[model samples]
Target: MPSRYVIVGGGIVGLATAHRILQDLPDADVTVLEKETAVGTHQTGHNSGVIHAGVYYKPGSLKALLCKAGSRSMADFCAEHGIPVKVCGKLIVATEEAELGRLRELYERSVANGLEVKLLDGPAAREFEPHVAALQAMHVASTGITDFAQVCRVLAELLVKGGAQVRLGTRVTGIRADRVLTDRGEIPYDTLVNCAGLHADRVARLAGADPQVRIVPFRGEYYELKPQRRDLVNGLIYPVPDPQFPFLGVHFTAMIDGNVHAGPNAVLAFKREGYRWRNVSIRDLAESAGYRGMWKLGRKHWRYGLDEMRRSLSPKRFAASLARLVPEVTLADLTPSGAGVRAQAIRPDGSLVDDFLIVRHGRQVHVLNAPSPAATSSLEIAKHIVAQLSA
Candidate 1:
């Protein structure tokens, strides 16, 4: 009998892993468990849809190493599979002279990561994005955009075709040495993989793995350009990195769907799956408020947290932030749009995990932290996780 491979979570990462397992060991019996009625209902479904080219990551990090390769593979896979994809490129703009140094650093880092980049002055930057404001910018030409949710569907279809089971609405409750206990019943498996994005840490602990990290949800809110104002952004317009902050400041993105998405200020989510302030959970709040990591993070970045919350509640503030990238944008041009909750892994020390965190425990593997580039790097991440399995 073939080894039964059971994967928890049906997001892009989970589905991609299932596809990889079948490719590596074609005879393996694979199963994917998703709590949602359909796949990609969370993080994979709600995102900026920018295919990153590893421009912003620190050199030699998993994100930097995998992103360039992932971009290539993702675009290739999308094209071969008949998915709509475009290499529209992006600009990391430094609106003020003080941010110029950071833009140069990002350019050098992009080069170190084996990517082609160009440093543009205000005039050259305007040549690319005529409506933008910039003292200087780093233009990353290989950045692209596509629908990651659709990618998940293709992976699911391919998995079923390979004699695998894609089970929906199956919530994992516990994990024994050789099986996963779900809301429905028990699922026996030879090996298990946890790609539970928001609940990854909990899932790890359920399987008796001391992941040493806690999953903290940060909700990123967005506003889209009104139909008449969509022309303000040409491609992805990002901000220069500010080392003092935990997140990159909000900017504009020209999504594949032709909507210009702007302003994603990160604020702590009361619920792990919270998309709005009203979507609260008493249980989720108790766990987060009770965690030492959450308290430590608040103590450390309380001011920034307040600022994020303030911005979240004010559309004018969001527009001001976006106006730094494209001066033509205004509060009147904005329209309410969707949001995505980032499953940021916070260590007990109050530090956020900056790279991919994959842990192996006997027959189980848990992904504790995978942030922004995750969607862009799902294919490569799947391969890396599966490569760790013992033959």
Candidate 2:
């Protein structure tokens, strides 16, 4: 008899993991349980769609390893599926003297991370990005853009073709090692994999596994440039970033569709899935407030949290942050865009989990936290999960 496997969450992580399992175990009966009406409706769909270049992660970390490998894998998948992607590259520009040192360090780290990068001074940087104002910059040629939602669709299609079942609109209410209870009914499975992006901790708990971390949702709001100003950014343009905050800071990104986007200010959302300021859930609010890990995080990152909240409400303030990267951008040329909520894992001591934390029980695995580079690293992450399961 084939081994029955149940996967929680229909985001990129779950779908990718299911696809990987079928690829490895040809006869495995894999069933994916998604809480939403469709796949990739949450984090995977809301992302900025930038292909990460493995520049920011520390050397030899899982994040670095996965990001580097997954980026190439994602691009390959796109090529095979007729999806278009542009490797237009990215510039980590440094406007001030103090930022120049960090820019150089990033360049070195890119080399160590096995990425193609170059360090450029003022005039040299201007040659590539004429509108950018920087004393120095690190040009990462591997960074690019693609529609991850489309990628998810392709992944689902591949899974179905491989004889795996994807159960969309079936919200998993409870999960155990051998049985998964959903809104529709119950499913019998020998193994369960939890890839619930936002509710991973809760899903693990439902499976009778105690994950000591809590997911603190951080909303990232963006601005799309006016059609006339689309030419402002040829590729991705980023700031040096503040070391205090986990965010990559407000920057400009050229989408694969030819439109330009800017200013994804990171802020804590009142609700776990809150995409708009008016959308609020009392249960979500109370759950976040009641978590001991959140209390610890609040105490540590109160200032950064407040700043992000201010930017979330005030478009003018958000525009100013984007202006720091591109001087030509103004308040009028910017318009409100979609928001993405990051499922950040918080420790009891108020420290943010900077690494990709994967917890495994006998026949189950839980992805507790996979933040920014997750989309770029989804395939490599899937391979790693398969390796873990096989081991």
Candidate 3:
């Protein structure tokens, strides 16, 4: 019998890993378990769709290194597979004098990451993004956008073509040493990979791996531009991020469909998979509220957390934040959009894991955290995970 590998979760990471494994070992029996009826239903589908330019990560960090390579690879893959991807470029604008210093720092980091970038003054920035207000900005010419759902579908297609089985609506309830207990039945496997996005820690624990870290789901809420207002944004427009916070501030993105989206304030979700304001699960809420990491994060960034909550509940407030970037945007030009849950890993020390966190335990590997650039870096992250696997 061929060696079996069972991977939990069917997001981009899981699909990417399955694809890589089959490519590397064609005879291996691979199975992907997704609780959702379809792939990319969570973060991957609701994401801003920006192909990050690796400007914010620390030099030599896994995120920076992989994002640079993965973004290019993602573009290439999309092109070869006939997926729609637009390399429309992005701008990190410094709207106020206080942000100028940070803008310069991002520019330096972008150069260190070996990406092509140009510095633009306020007027120069306006030349490209006429609606954006900024004193200075860094134009990352390589940043772009794509429909990751399409990418996930292609990945599934490729996996099927390579003879791998993806089992949807199959929830892995537990992971024993040599078997995965699922809602349908037990899957016997020699190797198990945990790519569970919002519940990575739980999956690792189920696999008998003691992951010291915990998965904290942060909800990022967005607003879409009205049909009349889509023309205001030509591409991606971002703010000079606050260095202290892990969440990127509200920004504008010209999606592949030519509509613009803005705001994704990072607020702690009451439920892991909660998107709408009224949706809640008591089990999910207790799980989050009881975690020691949750309190630690709250104690550290209570103010930012409160602000995120305020914005999430009030569209007018969210619109105000977006107006800072595009002065012409009015309350009427905005409408409620879907929210994405970010699986942020909070360490025991109360610090957010900004970089990709990967842990190895016996025959199993767990992805603790893979943030914003993750979608852009899926291919490279897959390669890294495969390389880390002990043969």
Per-residue accuracy of model 3 over 1-391 as CA lDDT, tens digit each: 9889898989999999999999888999999999999998888988988888788899999999999998899999999999999898898888899999888888888899999999999899999998899889889988988999999999998999899999999998877889999999999988888998998889988888888888887888888999888989988888889888778899888899877888888887777887875768888788778878778878988998888888877888988898888899988998877888888888777788889988888888898898778899999998998898844
What value does the lDDT take at residue 112 in candidate 2?
96
Candidate 1: regions farther than 4 A off: 244-246
Candidate order (lDDT): 1, 3, 2
Q: Which ranges in model 2 have alpha carbons more than 4 Å from their true place?
A: none
Show the colliding residue pairs in model 2.
none
Model 1: per-residue Cα lDDT over 1-391, one tens digit each: 9999999999999999999999999999999999999999999999988899998787888888778889999999999999999998999999997888888888888899999899999999999999989899888899999999999999999999999999998999999988899998998999999999999988999999999998888999999999998877788889996665547789888888889889689998999999999999998888888889889889998999998899999898888888888887889999999999999998887887888898898988898888789899999999999988863
What's the residue-level lDDT of 137 in candidate 3?
86
Worst 10 residues of 2 by lDDT: 241-250
Better model by lDDT, 2 or 3?
3
Considering every candidate listed, which one attains the maximal lDDT? 1
How many pairs collide in each candidate, listed in order?
Answer: 0, 0, 0
What TM-score, over all chains together, does every model reach?
Answer: 0.98, 0.98, 0.98
Off by over 4 Å in 3: none
TM-score ranking from best to worst?
Answer: 1, 3, 2
lDDT of 1: 0.90
